[model samples]
Target: MPVNMAEDGNVAPGLSAPIGGKKIFFVRHGKTEWNNQLRYQGATDIPLNAEGRLQARRAALRFSLAKVDAVISSPLSRAYETAEEIASFHKGAAVEKTSLLTEVDFGEWEGRTVAEIRENYAEIFEAWRVNQLNVDAPGGEKADDLYERCGELSKLLLARPERSIVVVGHGAMLRALFPRLLALPRVSYFWRTRIDNCSITAFGADAGRFVLLFQNDTTHLKVAEGRIASLPLL
Candidate 1:
């Protein structure tokens, strides 16, 4: 059996080699009022703004060209709808949703603004800013809990050797996800990584261990950074 190292994104320390398995793309759901406002958007279920819809459309255009096998998304309306848009653009694709992929549940602070969170729960908010796995949000899940939830489910998907899939979900979730792609360290989630709206990233697994191939590259978004001159050299 291959070890599930995606919790830390590690390579050799935890056994590294392609187990003839593959991982697919991880895309953050498009922006929303809360996202643009920098609010604690955990499980609030806000729909995409006009900007977000356009962003998803751009992702759809790109998806139409790429070859993806399936698409998964958070069960929230925003993510579910966004996944549907991408699914429609693809050839008879299915957009599936599951609780495992949902955004972090904020409990009492679900729809509140960041400023409100800071004002009402300053210390707790501070801990979150630093990415504490032990600190629960008001009444919601902390990083580690959500990680294991999404982590195990995602790994199950990667266990299959076939199927190039896409996952549409929230930023905080993706933040937790990126660092764990190869099962490195939980603390690595906050190493200045950013997952933008409708961005695309891909990874591969050696045996049960995973390896990151691409990360947050939305060049298909028609953004200035997507062009050839903007990409970095390997």
Candidate 2:
């Protein structure tokens, strides 16, 4: 289904689309303290901050009237909490956790700031920052490994019976996996895509191909307080 926002900037009721297939809405988890600090939170299991909780609630309201058959999320607390908020609106939809959706393991980089990475792991950080290389963190998950994991998740979701699903996850993992889900090119390219906290992105499978109905639409976040969510250094 194609989600629309009304003239008043509220999520409009009656989301419908001409091209129909299984629908997947990918939602990034709400703001965590690490998010604001621009720290790498890979595999850290950080919870939602106060503002994040409110954002999750607003995101919940966005789906209050929609038909979500299933809600899937990363096992990480941030993602699971966000999924829980969204699933609350759909009485029948229970939050399902999967390590397949977890953020890229930053390894030694976890909990470090971008500035720290630049200084400590200067060469690799520069390479990743400049070319989006498929490099691995010191003792952590590599970009290529994360891509394959995402492929597995894609297969799992497509094989399921649910027609509509909501997946709450981290930005880096979603960036790596979504391109594969859409059958796009190198996952590195999509690592540049900005997935704002609690933003709602949508797509549908049509004729065995995924159609991008919308990307990173944060209109629902208007209901929450005004604060820009900066990207966390993954």
Candidate 3:
């Protein structure tokens, strides 16, 4: 089972003093070319584009003053690049990559646009759009699979000794992880949540449970670029 998170208010930089618990900040990797093209990039190791690099820089600046003990990222280039940007600020913070943080495998649905998927696999696509839990991406993992991964990740995170950890990951995986951490209904929340690229979501660990500090925060992007309208809504 995944660790549950308690809902809370306005988030500050890192945890408040890092008293005795752990704080984990989740950052969605910057946009990729496929992201701009509205294509599914599940498990694809796409690199960040020019705009994405800039976004990553901005995200890094967002935590410049915070105390980051460690930075964990998906092995995918997009996420690793973003993690690099953030890790640059915290001089000694080690940036570690793990396959467990990789994006959900879209299988046959990978590298295709929603329209293309709908046109080709109409019934399955529509059913998935209506209720994601009812169907799986052709040959890909199901919600349970992703949820189990999230649970394993939670256990790993909780066991870590680091006080503040930054996790850079992909859209589908992060979306799946959030609901699982919050102990919410996965199917409903998964589709509804909008985890924009480079957005910052944070949580604090206490008493074997996590607390939601804030979620889907894009203040860094707005302040740095003032181009929130152009950002990808992954």
Candidate 4:
């Protein structure tokens, strides 16, 4: 809420010392071999594909027009590649990689699509969807783990003292973080907030307060360049 000074007649919240005014330029890594297979490529080091590279380029163009103070990303091949693409344009902006933003560790389900997982882990598969409980991914991180880590990343971004920052992260991790940021219910899955590859998400922040701006935007994607004919909508 904006407060107006009676005499000045100007709306001003009396700006406090700004935090990492860092705008997180969240991004989804490009396509991987597993992506083509429709598999869950979490915690796995999968590189981007040709189309994914192009998508990264398009995403960079979007950032080129924004105020990017720093670039931080997940320590995965795909995420790093996408960050590198953006750095190509902002030559001086360094890309920092951290494991905190990694996708959910899919454990036994890694590299396999849902169809395949259902064959053996049938009950677990069914349970996994509604398994929003504090459950584990068989051999992976629990629902709470991803949220905790991403939350840490969020706070770090807010404290950076920089005006804005960009974070390149995975979809599942992004899924986990969004709800927490919006004060939504904490669950493994929350209404399936899907984002496209090489997309950008923004959160408005000041002194650690967050307001969602736009999400899962892929207007930068070109029909001729992306693997998917059209960006998926959620």
Candidate 3 residue-wise lDDT, 1-234, digit = tens: 542223222244443322246889999999999999999999978999998999999888888777889999999999999999999989899799988899989889999998899899899877776666446889887867877888899888878899889999988888778766766665645678789999998887766777677788887777535444344322
Candidate 4: stretches off by over 4 Å: 1-22, 131-133, 188-190, 223-234
Whole-model lDDT per candidate: 0.73, 0.80, 0.82, 0.73
Q: What does each candidate score in C-alpha RMSD?
A: 5.6, 8.3, 6.9, 5.9
In Å, residue 224's CA in model 2 sits off its true spot by 7.3
lDDT of 2 by residue, 85-162 (tens): 889878889999989998888899999999999889999887776544377788788767777898899888778788
lDDT (C-alpha) at residue 231 in model 3: 43
Residue 197 of model 1: what lDDT?
A: 85
85-113: candidate 4 lDDT, tens digit per residue: 88766766899888788888989999888
| TM-score, every prediction | 0.81, 0.85, 0.85, 0.82
lDDT accuracy of residue 219 in candidate 1: 77
Lowest lDDT block of 10, candidate 3: 2-11
lDDT value, candidate 2, whole model: 0.80
Error of 2 at 63 (Å): 0.5
